[model samples]
Target: MYRIGEFSKICRVPVSALRYYSDLGLLPPESIDPESGYRYYSAGQLPRLNRILALKDLGLSLEEISAILDEDLPAGELRGMLRLKRAEIGQRVSEEQARLARVENRLRMIESEDRMPDQEIVLKELEDVPVVSIREVLSNPQDVGMLIADGYSALMPAGIMPIGACFSIYHDPEFDPTALDVEIAYPVAETVTDVPDTPGGRSFERRVVRGGRAAVTIHQGPYDMIDQVYTRIGKWISDHELQIAGEPQEAYLTAPDDPGGPVTEIRFPVA
Candidate 1:
């Protein structure tokens, strides 16, 4: 028999942790000192403590670890749980790698910030998106914001989802920013038009958020001054031996509506 302090030294675990494990019924001692209320663990419990530490390192919850130790789950279920854990770890690893790559690219840009020319657009085959839309006219730029919020609110209750960027199609150039007819949509199944009298009308089509194939320029500024962003993109395209093919789409990475952080990002579809 080993006293709690001696057991802790052998296990390299804190005394408080052993007490906690005991309280949680995870690793109870064989006996206790009644007069002093000190814990005394058997030499046999050392292996059990090692297993608990190993399980903890694998990110298993206490309950799961207890269940596993108790042999409550079958082998198949255990394998499935381990597989899910592996997939989750793989996803996190990929995300970290991508984040590191972005940071390195940004560092390079910062080093050459002064000599860095206007942004260049890359062409990519835009994926097909299925969207249900509501045809409404925006009274002003502010109304665009409200309409989007209202659409999200209305669709959330109905379970419609937005995929990438929530935006509008300018029906006419004369379409007033003060009074513009815009369609707010989210990519769902192409056939999910009818919702037994949904808030928005039915009849969705396969429309690729086109013109993304054109060269794009990123802008970091307020939404009101976004027109200057367009001008910069236009100049960049002209200078880079590219031509305009489709109308510009402003994909909001961040918006000026929020109090903190700079609003940025607009994509110009060009030939």
Candidate 2:
């Protein structure tokens, strides 16, 4: 048996922490002096103390730790919780890194405001892909994200996972910010059939995105500023004496909720 201070030294935990744990009934001492009330812990309590410290380090709240300890949570359950916390931390770190990159890009854009930075445009022959899609005429452009999310939700019930990136095809002959004729699509396996319908009464139909030569440019930043990249791509197409042949498409490379902003690849079919 060791006194509170001695046990603190042995466990490498502060005396105050030990006392607090004791008060919370999380790691009470094995014995206490009848007259002076001096707390004494035994080596046997080391395992319990270690568990409490471990859970706390994993970002478990004190109340949650107490419940877990008192309930004697199964080792497998505890391990599952740890795994979830690990994944959450990893996602947070990735988001922060992306945000830092966005900040740096923003600074560069601000510095080069006087001149148009060289935007790389690539001409590639795209292949036809079968997709499940939802077409809608949205009055407000902001609802486009929501529409895409709804399309995904509709697919979940049908056990359909997107095989490739989510993309939207602009069907309107000209750009209309107020009214968009957009088709939100997810590429799926050719064998997929019986697609689901969205809650908004739009059916998710299987369609082949026709293969063609296209001028593609990757735009990184907010969607509101995407028009600038489109302008640049248009200029590049004209400079190369190419004619726009079909509807435009934008594929989301990064998730819509990504911290760095949505990274979109814009494709304009050309001849």
Candidate 3:
């Protein structure tokens, strides 16, 4: 039998961690000295300690590891748990990759701070509006205009009265030019029940566009150059130490196909 300190050295685990495991009934010592209150572990417990360390390296919590070890789980159950852990790790890796990309993008924004647009950005409370929306996945951003037109045409036939400019809600966690998930919606005053088929062969559903504190900005020009506006707003939000509270909305203020000009107002909810 080895004392707790000696056992810790053998297992390459910290003395405090061993005591914690013992306290949690995960790796109790084989015997405890009644007089001195010392903890002693047997060589046989080394395998269990190794298992705990291995699972910890896989990002399993102590409580989960304790349950897994204490239950003497079957081989199939153990394999399934490991598989789930593997998938979770994969998802974490993807999230970290995205985070790294965002950090790099922020760095680029800082480098280009000199050329940032001087567009007027304002904070305002946008009132809630009811909308009939058609959500679809697009292979490219250029399809947004056609999809919005189709939505309007479908809604017009259904006698849906539009109150204001049509807007779109970006659903993708990050902006992707190659593939996008967006909801094109038109504000309506009257409650309508008919779900009209969009030009893209999708059904429109009624939903409320939540309103709150929003950082609003206008971009006048083509839609292709809108990324610059987005980058500017994102930088402004960060500069003010504000948190994005909800999804972004882009209200089209001009005709989508008009060569004259298409002005767009971008609103990002902030807290």
Candidate 4:
């Protein structure tokens, strides 16, 4: 048997930590004095202390480590827990990587142009895709979200996940401030036979968006500034001697409520 101080020296863990672990019922001393309240630990307890420290270094919370140690958890259960931790860390790393890329791109843009361009348009060939969509004549532009949500909600029951970003296809040749003809669509991997009805009793149908050549540009910031991006697209199409062959599309690349900045891809079909 070793006194608490001696045990702490041998295990290389502080007395406070040992006390904390003991208070949590993780590792208790071999015995405690009845009158003076001194604690004695056995050399055998060193192995348990080592395991706790090892798990702590692996980022496990004290509570989790306590449960794992107290229950003498099975190897499979421990592996499962570690797997979940790994996945969570991996997701964080991926998000950081994307942020890093954006930072690097911004640096390059500033160095080359003295400032970032308002909008950079490029031609891209969009491929045909299967989509579940809702066609609506929205009373105002603000109602776009309602239609998008309705389209997604109606399709969610089919258990099919969207393959890409949610996009809207404008059907009207010219713009109307109060009335808009829009088809909101979410691309899905597989087509569903059964159609679902929106909250307003409109049928959500599965259709293939045709493949075509279009000019695409990413708009960063609020939706209110999106019209400027469309202006650039129109100028680029005319410079290339191309005419607008079909309606414009806007694909949302980030959450609408993102505080940093929301990314929107504006595309116009050209021939």
Query: Which candidate has the top score in TM-score?
Result: 2
TM-score of each: 0.50, 0.56, 0.55, 0.56
Q: Which is the better candidate, 1 or 3, if ranked by TM-score?
A: 3
Off by over 4 Å in 1: 114-166, 169-248, 251-271
lDDT of 1 at 40: 92
- Against the true structure, whose lDDT is highest? 2
lDDT of 4: 0.84
Task: State the lDDT of candidate 3 residue by residue for 120-145, as single tens digits.
Answer: 67779998888889888889888998
Give the alpha-carbon lDDT of every model: 0.66, 0.88, 0.87, 0.84
What range of 10 consecutive residues in model 3 has the weakest lDDT sum? 114-123
Poorest stretch of ten by lDDT in candidate 4: 190-199
Stretches of candidate 4 exceeding 4 Å from the true structure:
1-116, 257-259
Instruction: Encode model 4's per-residue lDDT on 200-239: one tens digit a residue.
Output: 7888778899979988898888789777787777876776
Per-residue lDDT of 195-214 in model 2, one digit per residue for the tens? 86787778988999997999
Error of 3 at 174 (Å): 0.7
Model 2 reaches what TM-score against the true structure?
0.56
- Candidate 1 residue-wise lDDT, 142-189, digit = tens: 676665666666666766666655655555445367777666555566
Clashes of each: 3, 0, 0, 0
Question: How close to the true structure is residue 263 of candidate 4, measured as C-alpha lDDT?
Answer: 88
